[model samples]
Target: MRQPPSRTAVLKVTAYGLWGGAVCSAVVSLLVSLRFQSLAPGLDQKLFLVGGGMALLYAIGGCLAYPGLVFKPKEGQPG
Candidate 1:
Protein backbone atom coordinates (compact mmCIF):
# COMPACT_ATOMS: atom_id res chain seq x y z
CA MET A 1 0.00 0.00 0.00
CA ARG A 2 1.21 3.51 -0.68
CA GLN A 3 2.00 5.61 2.35
CA PRO A 4 -0.27 8.48 3.25
CA PRO A 5 0.71 12.12 3.30
CA SER A 6 1.29 14.07 6.49
CA ARG A 7 -1.98 14.21 8.39
CA THR A 8 -1.78 17.92 9.11
CA ALA A 9 -1.22 18.86 5.49
CA VAL A 10 -4.05 16.69 4.30
CA LEU A 11 -6.40 18.13 6.90
CA LYS A 12 -5.53 21.73 6.12
CA VAL A 13 -5.86 21.35 2.37
CA THR A 14 -9.03 19.36 2.51
CA ALA A 15 -10.63 21.74 5.00
CA TYR A 16 -9.97 24.75 2.82
CA GLY A 17 -11.19 23.03 -0.29
CA LEU A 18 -14.30 21.79 1.43
CA TRP A 19 -15.11 25.23 2.76
CA GLY A 20 -14.75 26.81 -0.66
CA GLY A 21 -16.80 24.11 -2.31
CA ALA A 22 -19.54 24.49 0.28
CA VAL A 23 -19.76 28.24 -0.19
CA CYS A 24 -19.88 27.91 -3.97
CA SER A 25 -22.57 25.26 -3.82
CA ALA A 26 -24.68 27.34 -1.46
CA VAL A 27 -24.54 30.37 -3.72
CA VAL A 28 -25.37 28.32 -6.80
CA SER A 29 -28.31 26.67 -5.07
CA LEU A 30 -29.65 30.00 -3.94
CA LEU A 31 -29.44 31.38 -7.43
CA VAL A 32 -31.07 28.35 -8.93
CA SER A 33 -33.88 28.52 -6.40
CA LEU A 34 -34.61 32.16 -7.13
CA ARG A 35 -34.28 31.86 -10.87
CA PHE A 36 -36.51 28.83 -11.23
CA GLN A 37 -38.95 29.52 -8.46
CA SER A 38 -40.95 31.69 -10.81
CA LEU A 39 -41.55 28.75 -13.10
CA ALA A 40 -42.32 26.15 -10.46
CA PRO A 41 -43.09 28.42 -7.51
CA GLY A 42 -41.20 26.09 -5.16
CA LEU A 43 -38.08 24.59 -6.74
CA ASP A 44 -35.84 24.70 -3.74
CA GLN A 45 -35.99 20.93 -3.39
CA LYS A 46 -34.51 20.35 -6.82
CA LEU A 47 -32.01 23.16 -6.45
CA PHE A 48 -30.74 21.61 -3.23
CA LEU A 49 -30.34 18.26 -4.91
CA VAL A 50 -28.28 19.77 -7.72
CA GLY A 51 -26.11 21.80 -5.36
CA GLY A 52 -25.60 18.85 -3.05
CA GLY A 53 -24.60 16.67 -5.97
CA MET A 54 -21.98 19.18 -7.09
CA ALA A 55 -20.58 19.49 -3.59
CA LEU A 56 -20.35 15.72 -3.33
CA LEU A 57 -18.41 15.58 -6.57
CA TYR A 58 -15.96 18.18 -5.33
CA ALA A 59 -15.46 16.26 -2.09
CA ILE A 60 -14.84 13.03 -3.94
CA GLY A 61 -12.25 14.64 -6.16
CA GLY A 62 -10.51 16.18 -3.17
CA CYS A 63 -10.39 12.82 -1.40
CA LEU A 64 -9.02 11.05 -4.45
CA ALA A 65 -6.25 13.58 -4.95
CA TYR A 66 -5.33 13.80 -1.26
CA PRO A 67 -3.01 10.82 -1.43
CA GLY A 68 -0.87 12.47 -4.09
CA LEU A 69 -0.68 15.82 -2.33
CA VAL A 70 2.63 14.66 -0.85
CA PHE A 71 4.37 11.98 -2.77
CA LYS A 72 6.56 9.56 -0.86
CA PRO A 73 10.30 9.72 -1.49
CA LYS A 74 11.20 6.23 -2.49
CA GLU A 75 14.42 5.00 -0.87
CA GLY A 76 17.08 4.19 -3.47
CA GLN A 77 14.56 4.71 -6.25
CA PRO A 78 15.86 6.87 -9.07
CA GLY A 79 13.81 9.89 -10.13
Candidate 2:
Protein backbone atom coordinates (compact mmCIF):
# COMPACT_ATOMS: atom_id res chain seq x y z
CA MET A 1 0.00 0.00 0.00
CA ARG A 2 1.16 3.55 -0.75
CA GLN A 3 1.85 5.88 2.12
CA PRO A 4 -0.38 8.95 2.47
CA PRO A 5 0.96 12.36 1.51
CA SER A 6 2.42 14.43 4.32
CA ARG A 7 0.72 17.69 5.26
CA THR A 8 3.59 19.73 3.87
CA ALA A 9 3.51 17.90 0.56
CA VAL A 10 -0.22 18.40 0.24
CA LEU A 11 0.12 22.08 1.01
CA LYS A 12 2.92 22.48 -1.51
CA VAL A 13 0.92 20.84 -4.25
CA THR A 14 -2.14 22.94 -3.40
CA ALA A 15 -0.11 26.12 -3.43
CA TYR A 16 1.58 25.32 -6.72
CA GLY A 17 -1.69 24.48 -8.40
CA LEU A 18 -3.50 27.55 -7.10
CA TRP A 19 -0.58 29.86 -7.91
CA GLY A 20 -0.20 28.50 -11.41
CA GLY A 21 -3.92 28.67 -12.04
CA ALA A 22 -4.13 32.22 -10.71
CA VAL A 23 -1.26 33.37 -12.90
CA CYS A 24 -2.71 31.72 -15.98
CA SER A 25 -6.15 33.14 -15.21
CA ALA A 26 -4.72 36.61 -14.77
CA VAL A 27 -2.88 36.46 -18.08
CA VAL A 28 -5.97 35.23 -19.90
CA SER A 29 -8.20 37.82 -18.22
CA LEU A 30 -5.79 40.60 -19.11
CA LEU A 31 -5.66 39.57 -22.74
CA VAL A 32 -9.43 39.29 -22.90
CA SER A 33 -10.02 42.66 -21.24
CA LEU A 34 -7.53 44.31 -23.58
CA ARG A 35 -9.40 43.03 -26.60
CA PHE A 36 -12.82 43.59 -25.06
CA GLN A 37 -13.12 46.97 -26.73
CA SER A 38 -12.41 45.44 -30.12
CA LEU A 39 -14.35 42.17 -30.08
CA ALA A 40 -18.04 42.18 -30.92
CA PRO A 41 -20.20 41.83 -27.81
CA GLY A 42 -21.08 38.25 -28.72
CA LEU A 43 -17.47 37.30 -29.30
CA ASP A 44 -16.47 38.98 -26.05
CA GLN A 45 -18.99 36.96 -24.10
CA LYS A 46 -17.84 33.76 -25.76
CA LEU A 47 -14.21 34.50 -24.94
CA PHE A 48 -15.02 35.24 -21.30
CA LEU A 49 -17.08 32.07 -21.00
CA VAL A 50 -14.36 29.89 -22.50
CA GLY A 51 -11.60 31.47 -20.47
CA GLY A 52 -13.49 31.06 -17.21
CA GLY A 53 -14.31 27.48 -18.11
CA MET A 54 -10.66 26.66 -18.72
CA ALA A 55 -9.64 28.28 -15.46
CA LEU A 56 -12.17 26.16 -13.53
CA LEU A 57 -10.84 23.05 -15.25
CA TYR A 58 -7.30 23.96 -14.24
CA ALA A 59 -8.40 24.50 -10.65
CA ILE A 60 -10.02 21.05 -10.59
CA GLY A 61 -6.81 19.50 -11.89
CA GLY A 62 -4.99 21.14 -9.00
CA CYS A 63 -7.09 19.28 -6.41
CA LEU A 64 -6.60 15.97 -8.17
CA ALA A 65 -3.79 13.49 -7.38
CA TYR A 66 -0.37 13.38 -9.02
CA PRO A 67 0.44 12.11 -12.47
CA GLY A 68 1.67 8.46 -12.57
CA LEU A 69 2.43 8.40 -8.84
CA VAL A 70 -1.11 9.09 -7.76
CA PHE A 71 -4.43 7.96 -9.19
CA LYS A 72 -3.72 9.80 -12.42
CA PRO A 73 -2.53 7.61 -15.26
CA LYS A 74 0.30 8.26 -17.67
CA GLU A 75 -0.46 9.43 -21.17
CA GLY A 76 -1.13 6.61 -23.70
CA GLN A 77 -1.78 4.15 -20.84
CA PRO A 78 -5.09 2.34 -20.97
CA GLY A 79 -7.61 3.38 -18.36
Candidate 3:
Protein backbone atom coordinates (compact mmCIF):
# COMPACT_ATOMS: atom_id res chain seq x y z
CA MET A 1 0.00 0.00 0.00
CA ARG A 2 1.14 3.58 -0.65
CA GLN A 3 1.87 5.82 2.29
CA PRO A 4 -0.23 8.93 2.78
CA PRO A 5 1.40 12.29 2.35
CA SER A 6 2.62 14.13 5.43
CA ARG A 7 0.87 17.22 6.83
CA THR A 8 3.78 19.46 5.98
CA ALA A 9 3.87 18.28 2.39
CA VAL A 10 0.16 18.94 1.97
CA LEU A 11 0.46 22.38 3.50
CA LYS A 12 3.44 23.23 1.29
CA VAL A 13 1.49 22.30 -1.81
CA THR A 14 -1.51 24.33 -0.72
CA ALA A 15 0.64 27.33 -0.02
CA TYR A 16 2.31 27.15 -3.42
CA GLY A 17 -1.01 26.80 -5.16
CA LEU A 18 -2.42 29.82 -3.39
CA TRP A 19 0.60 31.90 -4.23
CA GLY A 20 0.42 30.91 -7.88
CA GLY A 21 -3.25 31.88 -7.97
CA ALA A 22 -2.41 35.23 -6.47
CA VAL A 23 0.16 35.89 -9.18
CA CYS A 24 -2.23 34.90 -11.91
CA SER A 25 -5.00 37.11 -10.55
CA ALA A 26 -2.71 40.11 -10.29
CA VAL A 27 -1.38 39.64 -13.83
CA VAL A 28 -4.83 39.26 -15.32
CA SER A 29 -6.08 42.34 -13.49
CA LEU A 30 -3.18 44.41 -14.77
CA LEU A 31 -3.72 43.29 -18.32
CA VAL A 32 -7.43 43.97 -18.21
CA SER A 33 -6.95 47.37 -16.68
CA LEU A 34 -4.39 48.36 -19.27
CA ARG A 35 -5.95 46.83 -22.34
CA PHE A 36 -9.50 48.09 -21.94
CA GLN A 37 -9.12 51.78 -22.47
CA SER A 38 -12.80 52.16 -23.41
CA LEU A 39 -14.08 50.99 -20.05
CA ALA A 40 -16.12 53.42 -17.94
CA PRO A 41 -14.09 56.10 -16.17
CA GLY A 42 -13.89 54.31 -12.82
CA LEU A 43 -14.72 50.71 -13.72
CA ASP A 44 -11.18 49.78 -14.51
CA GLN A 45 -10.01 51.20 -11.22
CA LYS A 46 -12.59 49.15 -9.37
CA LEU A 47 -11.60 45.98 -11.15
CA PHE A 48 -7.95 46.58 -10.39
CA LEU A 49 -8.72 47.22 -6.75
CA VAL A 50 -10.83 44.10 -6.47
CA GLY A 51 -8.14 42.00 -8.10
CA GLY A 52 -5.49 43.43 -5.78
CA GLY A 53 -7.68 42.58 -2.82
CA MET A 54 -8.08 39.00 -4.02
CA ALA A 55 -4.33 38.67 -4.48
CA LEU A 56 -3.73 40.00 -1.01
CA LEU A 57 -6.21 37.56 0.47
CA TYR A 58 -4.62 34.61 -1.30
CA ALA A 59 -1.13 35.62 -0.25
CA ILE A 60 -2.24 36.08 3.33
CA GLY A 61 -3.89 32.68 3.40
CA GLY A 62 -0.79 31.05 1.95
CA CYS A 63 1.43 32.72 4.52
CA LEU A 64 -0.85 31.67 7.32
CA ALA A 65 -1.05 28.09 6.05
CA TYR A 66 2.73 27.71 5.66
CA PRO A 67 4.61 30.21 7.77
CA GLY A 68 7.78 28.16 7.45
CA LEU A 69 8.02 29.37 3.86
CA VAL A 70 8.40 32.95 5.09
CA PHE A 71 10.33 32.42 8.32
CA LYS A 72 13.38 30.26 8.81
CA PRO A 73 13.62 27.93 11.78
CA LYS A 74 15.98 28.84 14.57
CA GLU A 75 19.35 27.15 14.67
CA GLY A 76 19.20 23.56 15.92
CA GLN A 77 15.45 23.42 15.36
CA PRO A 78 13.96 20.89 12.97
CA GLY A 79 12.44 22.74 10.05
* Model number with the top lDDT: 3
Better by lDDT, candidate 3 or 2: 3
Model 2 lDDT per residue over 1-79, tens place:
9777765466557757865885698579658956894767567667766777777666666655444333544444322
Listed per model in order, the count of residue pairs whose N, CA or C atoms clash below 3 Å is: 0, 0, 0
- Which pairs in model 3 have colliding backbones? none
Give Cα distance to truth, residue 60, candidate 2, Å.
Answer: 0.6
Candidate 1: segments with Cα more than 4 A from true spot: 1-5, 45-79
lDDT of 1 by residue, 1-79 (tens): 9776666566557756875786688778778877787677457778877887887777665655454445443344332
TM-score (all chains, Cα) for each model: 0.49, 0.48, 0.77
lDDT of every predicted structure (CA atoms): 0.67, 0.64, 0.76
Q: How many pairs of residues collide in model 1? A: 0
**Winning candidate number (TM-score):** 3
When 1 and 3 are scored with TM-score, the better candidate is 3
> C-alpha displacement of 5 in model 3, angstroms?
1.1
